[model samples]
Target: MTIRFAAVSACALLTLAACNRTQEPVAPASAAATPPVESPAIPAADPNALTAEGLGPVRIGMTRADLVKLWGEDSQPNAVGGPDPETCDEFHPAKAPADVMVMIQNGVLTRITLTRGATIKTDRGFGVGDSAMAIKQAYGGAIVAQPHKYQDAPAEDLFAWPHGGATTYVTDPAARGVRYEIGGDGKVMKVHAGDPSIQQVEGCL
Candidate 1:
């Protein structure tokens, strides 16, 4: 009888242990799973960014009347009449940025010039104060180095045919580009974006 009682007690203890183990909560299979990390969103292009196309609302091939309507009356006090005053002329829009100037050729907008005091950057990520090397790195083989008209070495015109258009001649009306005029200081003095007019040594040619 004593042996039977001991055997029954041992069986009861084992069953209780098994019940306790089973009663403990079992972890879900996904509990150890990690959530996926999302990548950061890319930044949008600046609206006022200068490009081969144009700057903000001003666009290449736009008519003078359209420009005037957008930025009020245009002013050209230093008109030299390169070939024809009505055709090759430059003007400042009253409501435009202080350092920006527009070139009109054949009665249409052709080039946009960013002079000193301009803080705007090109679509390629360059500005007035950037170095020639910076421009070169931004454009790589697309850059065409030309001798500066006035300054010595280190000062040169860095032209980039960003649109993959004409590389040899500036007469391709369909071609578009940007030019960085590096000064004797080895810093960009001016930036031009538009047609072959960007290759002009003088203001209007």
Candidate 2:
């Protein structure tokens, strides 16, 4: 894949609540790829405001019943290749305005991904189509940029979450709770929320 495409996927995947242990994630290095020139203009988002903690009534630690009660029965309540397939339940919230996906692990919600032109934005006010530079400026140095696994660019991963404790001291990969996926063209394309599980790329293999 192109370096920018790889970065795009990583950022998008991470935001979709796919992540690793607390240690800063390292994107796989590209042996023969160049940096993306500029991010292209992506679709506008759904404008459903959300929090770093979650979107609307859904919170990170909520349960299946809670979701069912709030959203009724999910049309697809299972993601076969999810981090914990046996325990993971995926959903596409019917009443939501955006293209939303939620995953529950071990009976508690773990991730929420917005795609297909969902205009959801965090309480911080970042959303799809925003420039990486704009996001970096808005967060003001809190982001931990990671190399794209297959890209030659400097930062394919812009991360935000809580860390720095003996228990969480860089080992709880999920601590970097949110990711804003920037495409080769440099604009945000996807937004993800949840814990370390959000770091996942291709699903549990």
Highest lDDT, which number? 1
Candidate 2 lDDT, 49-121, residue by residue in tens:
6555677777777787787787766655563536565576566766655577777778777778776587777
**Clash tally, candidates in order:** 0, 24
Summarize candidate 1's per-residue lDDT along 38-147 as a digit string, tens digits.
89988889998999899888898899889888876665556454667676887778888888888888789999999999999998789999999877887788899988
Off by over 4 Å in 1: 1-28, 31-34, 76-83
RMSD of 2: 34.0
Cα deviation of 2, candidate 2, in Å:
99
**C-alpha RMSD between model 1 and the true structure:** 4.9
Candidate 1 local distance difference test against the native: 0.86
